[model samples]
Target: MPKMKSHSGTKKRFRRTGTGKLMRGKAFKSHILTKKSTKRKRGFRQETVISNADKRVVSTRLAGR
Candidate 1:
């Protein structure tokens, strides 16, 4: 069989932790910051853990990374 390929978009957006959980960036901090409260904006700045339901999809796309 040919080598499996990593999903380019997933590779760019997600990473696997040492323990195997997928790490992802929190949403909504990318734009329109002026309307959101400072606290809320700060919360979005933090890295987030990908949900369990989505982890399998990410792992498959990442080729078991």
Candidate 2:
């Protein structure tokens, strides 16, 4: 059987942590930085775990990893 392919976009956007939880980047940090507060921008630098609602879908997409 052929190998299953990973979702390229999901692979780039999500990552597995040491304990296996999925981590993802914060949105809204990629544009219009001039209007955003420094604290808000700083907050975006941290990675967040995927929500329980989306965790299953994301894990399937990331399965090939």
Candidate 3:
């Protein structure tokens, strides 16, 4: 059987923690930041965990053993 390749985009954007949780960047911080409040920007700067609903998909993409 052929080896399954991990999703390149997912690999770059998501990380697997020691406990197996997926770490990802918070959304809405990539553009139009000037209009957002300083507090909102600060909030977005924090790292976010992938929701349980999305964790499975991310784990599949990551292809961790």
Top model number, TM-score: 2
Tens-place lDDT per residue, model 2, 1-65, is 78888899999999999899999999999988999999999999999998999999999888964
**Model 2, CA-based lDDT:** 0.94
- Name the runs in model 3 displaced over 4 angstroms: none
User: How many residue pairs clash in model 2?
Assistant: 0
User: Using TM-score as the measure, what is the rank order of every candidate, best first?
Assistant: 2, 1, 3
Of candidates 3 and 2, the better by TM-score = 2
Q: Each model's C-alpha lDDT?
A: 0.86, 0.94, 0.88
TM-score of 1: 0.88
The candidate maximizing lDDT is 2
Pairwise TM-score winner, candidates 1 and 3: 1
lDDT of 1 by residue, 6-57 (tens): 8899999998889977899988888888999999987987788998899778
Summed over model 3, clashes come to: 0
State the TM-score for model 3.
0.87
lDDT of 2 at 12: 97
**Deviation from native of the Cα of residue 10 in model 3, angstroms:** 0.6
Off by over 4 Å in 2: none
